[model samples]
Target: MRRVPDVRPPALRPAAVLPGPAPRRGPVTVALAGAEFGWGSSGKLSAVLSALRERARLPLRFVGLASGLGRPLLAEHSVEHWYDLPDAAADRRAAVGRIVRSHGVRAAVVVLDGAIATALQAAGVPTVFVDSLPFLWTEGDRAALPLDATVYCAQQCVGLPPECEGILASVASLRWVEAVIGTPPAGSTGTPGTPGTRTWRKALVSLGGLGAPRLPDRTAYPRVVVPAVLDALAEHGVQEAHLAGNLPAGLLGGLVERPPAGLRVTAGPLPHSAFLSELTRCDVLLASPGLTTLLEAGRLGVPTVCLPPQNLSQIFNGRFHSRAVGVDVRVVWPENVFREEEALGLRAKGEDHALELIYGGIGRVAARADGTPGAAGLRAAVLAAVRRAAGGADWGALTAAVGTGGAAQVAEALLAIAGPTPARGA
Candidate 1:
């Protein structure tokens, strides 16, 4: 059994130290937070951190706000402080204000966690907000966002649907940016996927961040999606594959009676760097289509296929990938299960309403597998989608469509927001 990494930082006890007056000058403090939904926010946060470090004129002090689900992903970065955000709106604002005052936080970099960004600004801290899913937003989500953020960096997409317009227009200073994905290795001229037929030997199936707090049974996605994905990969001659994400325990042994193609499959969560390493080694990526992973794989020129999306943002991501590459690589539920567009239509009611349809459909399929109704048709749908991606795909087109300079772009914006004080804080 391959050991799954427990990447959360170890808690330390405060030790008494010789009392020395706090230094008058040091690194400028920057508070970071990603939406607790998944690893995408943390990935974007890490990329921006790297960019800030690379481009900083003065030393930087990094802290975290609401590192709940994203803590494992953020463990790799230098976030000296981590504070769990409160649930109540009033408490959340009070906690953020305390963090800002205590750390002397001058500016903040927030990805998707709109509430925290709004709170930071309430505390008089300038926030550079990253809205990666502008295409998925609606009027219902307006209150969560810091509409008057100092700098709201909305990622560029193929299209901003009607649902997003009102919320996007609400932002005070919205600046468009390229995909905020991790940078590729320097001087590496690796070709996309496998050469010739693109028959993949090693595969990576990413279920994305599965610990969605909304989900009662997070296993519903992996239990149903994994078997279908493994079947497809095996049929395509893949010999080895790694299933990456925060997944349920004993899911493989329980769900998959037989591992396809005599294939070796390892399931577990990976830190950002390790996940990128797996991307480089694999010939093809079959994933739940989180925007960050798609954009990163695009930068790496990796052949990619979209598994059924688990959320509103993912639906847009899968569609965006298909449009950019001119390939219908996304696997979606059957109409009998739930029409994708219909589910999307519920965005006005809130992301939860849209996700209810998606999750309910997936739950039905999973229940069917347990002899409730039947999951054969749903599994077959996924199988077909994976096979279609194998035919041939221009995966790099996504990268070309959205340049990979977003990290640097966000970093520059933060510096500008930080202004003369922090720039000269040293």
Candidate 2:
């Protein structure tokens, strides 16, 4: 087995043109919010907030209404103006209204949380709600009224509660398309096309979102699975396996000290943008079935092999992305990857499993480059929808209609309604 040197020779490609630095945009304020809730909720909410910040091309200000759990991480990108949550839900609504009116906001974009949606809707503000997780609720059930428009990431709401209703506007990623498109080219793997040093030539592994248990069987699953993946890759005659995502220090240090004969693992959390950039260079990815990572892999055109955690959410996510998107990949129990009936006893089941895995792997890799489906098309479509609703006039209606663009669209709508920056706020 051959190992890729930890270093690579620089690839002599033409320097990719960098977009001119993000222009500072305005006093047109919108809140990037989350329930001042738990870590899981905040992390999910932040992914949406980050996407909104990425798409806004014009000068703008973001006010965060929840706590700083997600905000501080975002401080490097732009100054976020946050509002404290009021004691009651009613007070929270009134507070948000005051903030919007004071800042002259035309739109409030909610990244598909029930509590956040309820607050903005109660305030009677025009809003664009980008619902990435349909399993949360159906559009009508979730939003009740015909929202100016709604956008969803998954195909129509399947597991959604009875309440959601709205036309399907677009499939948007919780991920920032800009993050993937802006990745720098990686240096070459000096080891050439040689097979890897261990049996596993190329391996990518991750435990999504801080290594918290994603499935019921998760606690012991990783312990059993990672070693199996390493062993299988070793058997396949690959040299090195790369580990990515949240890894505990003690366990990681232990792995490093003794180390698998030829395997190498890098530990520590990477800056979000940097991690996706590095993703361009990976051969295959192994991770818990998180929509964010799976979508990222799809965009990068990387083949993935997954072991679904035994939790309902992880199971649903794994099944959905694999079967629906028709990506080429494998999603199986750990036992399946190593079991041997040789061929006869479990022939049909084994064949079906192999086909699904291989098909998903090859299919997703062939789908498209990450971030290729530009948001411009959606923006144009949204503007048209808002215009028709407005009878070709500028009104606050556009805010409700443009759901996916979030900050950028809201800023545009505000420009249409409130006009340019004026003297000082009253």
Candidate 3:
């Protein structure tokens, strides 16, 4: 049986002595970058990677192991081959190393931290872990996650979790792609809307891509939660309600079947742009806490009624968003919201009432994922740093954060940074 390297290393004792400065590479070379992008989730991630790659001139060869969920969006950017390897992490690392050598790749970029990332790092590959997505980096001992260097969305989001103070990369995600990407559909100005100023008549309920790939409603969290919202809306006399998400209609058939007469539920897949646009149109958003949707809704100035799922990661996301910014809160008993099926059933009808209370207290806590001044500023820095290190002509500072990644620039950056490393125990 094949074994995967324990990427999350065991606890280490504290030390004071510092090692002498090790040899520094003349430049950075990126061989490949992997992100599990698909239609519903990680679409922004792949796009961000592409843009970063282009700016850095790193050549990227994507390995579409899981499925072509993000293939359509990827196809639009560049027609790269969909490479796949064995499922095991060790095997993946081996395969990736082979590909890197064959393609003459030096370092690899893993868009988000996960099995693939850990595996690549285990293979002794020079890696850059990009904390672009909201991966509760707030809690983990990031140093344990294998990587030569790290980049995060913002310094606020990085650092050692409370339990351990380990070495983490100076790279901040927010700083990495600010100027290179586009902003959310909502304008970037003032503090993000809080729950106090805006009054929402009804709370929109969804679990986000309910029937889709990353998150499925096998346990029917949506079924339990949406019905509660429907009941709440009816009681408040909020006749018209919009249900936006990808929850399967069949799973939610019962809730919709008797949906209190006048409420309108529109459920299907909407691209990220359209999704943000719809958020602007809606007043209240009641849903599970997913990074993309939650962040966008917050950015759009929409009050969020978050029902965090059972997963520790989900709970962390909900708690962080709530505490970090002021939003309404429903303290579901037992840390795990997924376990509270009974609560879901009882509160399903009262969700709208909760939303109303939440709307009454407008709060501000969110940043635009793209094109905001903050985001744009970060992108320009990365581009400038890469060009200076590469000795490339100073392309003036990047002003706007474009939504798409530029692969050609990535290719150039990677080659500039890459150099020969001796095989194990040279």
For all candidates in order, the CA lDDT equals 0.78, 0.41, 0.41
What TM-score does each of the candidates earn?
A: 0.88, 0.53, 0.55
| Model 3, global lDDT | 0.41
Between candidates 1 and 3, the one scoring higher on lDDT is: 1
Q: Pick the candidate with the highest TM-score.
A: 1
| Per-residue alpha-carbon lDDT of candidate 3 for residues 1-426, written as tens digits (9 for 90 to 100) | 122122321111111111234234232334334344223234444444555443432234443333344444344344344556676666877886676565444556554434555665565555544443333332233443443443222212211242222223333322232211223453632134422223345555555433332332233444444555565555444556666554455655655666766666555545445555566666556566654455555445455555534233344455555544432343332322124334223232332233222222111101223212232332333223222222211111111111122222222223333434334333
TM-score of 2: 0.53
- lDDT-best of 1 and 2: 1
lDDT of 2 by residue, 303-419 (tens): 455454322244445654444333323444423332222211222332234333432332332244631122233223322322222221111111112122323333233233322
Q: Rank the candidate models, highest TM-score first.
A: 1, 3, 2
Q: What is the lDDT of residue 68 in candidate 1?
A: 78
Off by over 4 Å in 2: 1-26, 34-58, 65-76, 81-106, 135-202, 209-242, 246-258, 324-328, 334-423
Clashing pairs for model 1 are none
